[model samples]
Target: MDIEYSFNKRPTTDQIIELYDNAGLPRPTNDKERMEQMFENSNLIITAWDNELLVGVSRSITDWVWACYLSDLAVRGDYKKMGIGRKLISLTKEKVGNQSMVLLLSVPTAIEYYPKVGFKKQESSFIIEREQ
Candidate 1:
């Protein structure tokens, strides 16, 4: 498959919702407004496409000098195990350069996947639960 990758090319909310569903990544697809805001406020977005299909994405917020929070990383279920996820991460880090470290809060299913992509496991992070 010839997969194309793009940076900061925002897909429509409908496309995003479809992709999240197909990828099995749970998100607030029921609330289009919130979904739009999520992508709007993010500074970095990298997406993979198979022709017209949205197959994978990596969304992040970064300062380019200190820290980069990779908020979302998803690959369509049928497209998994094909290195698209790794490439998205590679591209994200490439854009951020070496001055900043990339961080993400992994869903339980992805805890093992991160280490293979060059992320060191950290137990020092903390988060207050989101009420929603």
Candidate 2:
């Protein structure tokens, strides 16, 4: 099935949670308000659709010139291995252009996947763990 991709098309909370859950990405799915804020706060939102079904999404916050933090990249389980994730990242890079760098914090399971999609593992990055 061909996937239709779009930019800044903020998905409904339901669609976002569904994708996150099915993709095995840990998110506050039960908290509707938090999910709303997650998408609401992001500036760059790319989505993939399979004839009205939300199958994949790449959400990021960026300056559009300096750096892009790709916060979430999720695709439904059935859609995995079809290069949907790769395409989402590629489209995101296309949007931000060459001057800006795209960065992400990979979940333990996805550490290997990111490098395959043109991400170079960096050693100098640091993060203060989110207080849950």
**Number of the top-ranking candidate, with TM-score as the measure:** 1
Worst 10 residues of 1 by lDDT: 7-16
lDDT of 2 by residue, 35-110 (tens): 9999999999999999989999999999999999999999999999999999999999999999999999998999
Which residue pairs in candidate 1 collide? none
Every model's TM-score: 0.97, 0.97
What residue runs in model 2 are displaced by over 4 Å at the alpha carbon? none
Instruction: Compose the digit string of candidate 1's lDDT tens values, residues 42-85.
Output: 99999999998899999999999999999999999999999999
Q: What C-alpha lDDT values do all the predictions have?
A: 0.93, 0.92
